[model samples]
Target: MTALPETTAKKLGLVIDLDTCVGCHACVVACKGWNTENYGAPLSDQSAYGAAPKGTFLNRVHAYEVQPDTGAAQTVHFPKSCLHCEDAPCVTVCPTGASYKRVEDGIVLVNEDDCIGCGLCAWACPYGARELDKAAGVMKKCTLCVDRIYNENLPEEDREPACVRTCPAGARHFGDLGDPGSAVSQLVIEREGVDLMPELGTKPVNKYLPPRPKDVLDEIDVLSPFLAPVAEESKGLAGWLDRVLEKI
Candidate 1:
């Protein structure tokens, strides 16, 4: 069993705004594209055109229609991936020590070379973040785009995770949450961000900003305009035209 570091130097993670995510799935696509080409072994698809199709993806977006207490029902787009928890159960459960959390950045990663393709890490993750790549014969999850974030060859602006960069709605943010002065930490404090199932004691690094109440529109009667008379009588030259038309 692998033991987690007592503390990480920095908690690098994401702050996802539930209210602003548009459910466009841009992040999902970006994640899949970047990971397949740049990261470890390429993500695979099993019988993509067959009746049962399966594919490996690092990120996924789920939408839910929720009714708030004071407003109309609204759809919330939730993006889910590995949280890089402080007490990640997946790390502890790995028999081969393939899964480990980085003490420098607090990012949980799996060493594919050391992986035995055991499903224990997937079973241990509470957020359902781990997926077994059938083609590669290894368990895979979001690395927070470790390769891209640290690649100095890329532009400074492009150094962040691909999902954060491609999010059209600007709902995803990446930063060091451990620093109180960081923008992500400030955003979480202002938005009252909540953890995903805090009761489980995972202490997930990723935070989700709750969706704000939507404005309710007043009900309108569609037939009201047609039901009312346009005018009591046709007046002036219009009345004379009306009389002539009636005679005709």
Candidate 2:
């Protein structure tokens, strides 16, 4: 069993705002595109054109329709990825020294070259955040865009993970969770960010800002304009079209 590092100065991780995510899947595609090339191996699909196609992806978003007793149904978009926990179970279970956490930034990563494709790390992770790389015969996961975030070759503004960079809603943020002064930490403090499944005790670095309650729309009849019958003044389809055009 691999032991975790003693301590870390920075808990470099992601902060996802559920209220702002639009379920666009932009973050998922951005992560896939950048990691496939930046990381050691390509995220390939097996039998892509066949009846059952399976592909590797580092991040995934899920949409849920939630109904409240008091209001209308709400659609929540959730993005999931590695949390880079302080007590990461995935690191402790690795038979080889392939999985490890960085003390510098608390980023958990698998050494692809040393990995044996045993699937132990995947099983150990409670979040189901890992995948087997069939092309490379190793375990693979989110690297937090280490290559891009710290790359001197890239512009400083372009240093963040592709998901954070590409989020149209600006729902995703990346920063040091360890520092109270950091934007991510301050956001978490202000929004009361929560950890997923806190009972498991992973001490996950990533935090999720809950969706703020929206103004009640149930009281307003949104379909009122369409609900009312077409004006009797308009006789037929052509006449109705003309009337609609005239109103505009």
Q: What C-alpha lDDT, on a 0 to 100 scale, does residue 132 get in candidate 2? A: 94
Candidate 2 C-alpha lDDT tens digits along 1-248: 26799788789999999999998999999998998877789888899899999889889998888998965899999999998899899999998889999888989988887888999989989998999978888888999999989999999989999999999999999999999999999999999999998999999999999999887545767778778576667578989898899999
lDDT scores of the candidates, listed in order: 0.93, 0.91
> Per-prediction TM-score, please?
0.86, 0.86
Residue 105: error of model 2 in Å? 0.8
- Which residue pairs overlap in candidate 2's backbone? none
Q: lDDT of model 1 at residue 57?
A: 89
The number of residue pairs in model 1 that clash at the backbone is: 0
Off by over 4 Å in 2: 217-248
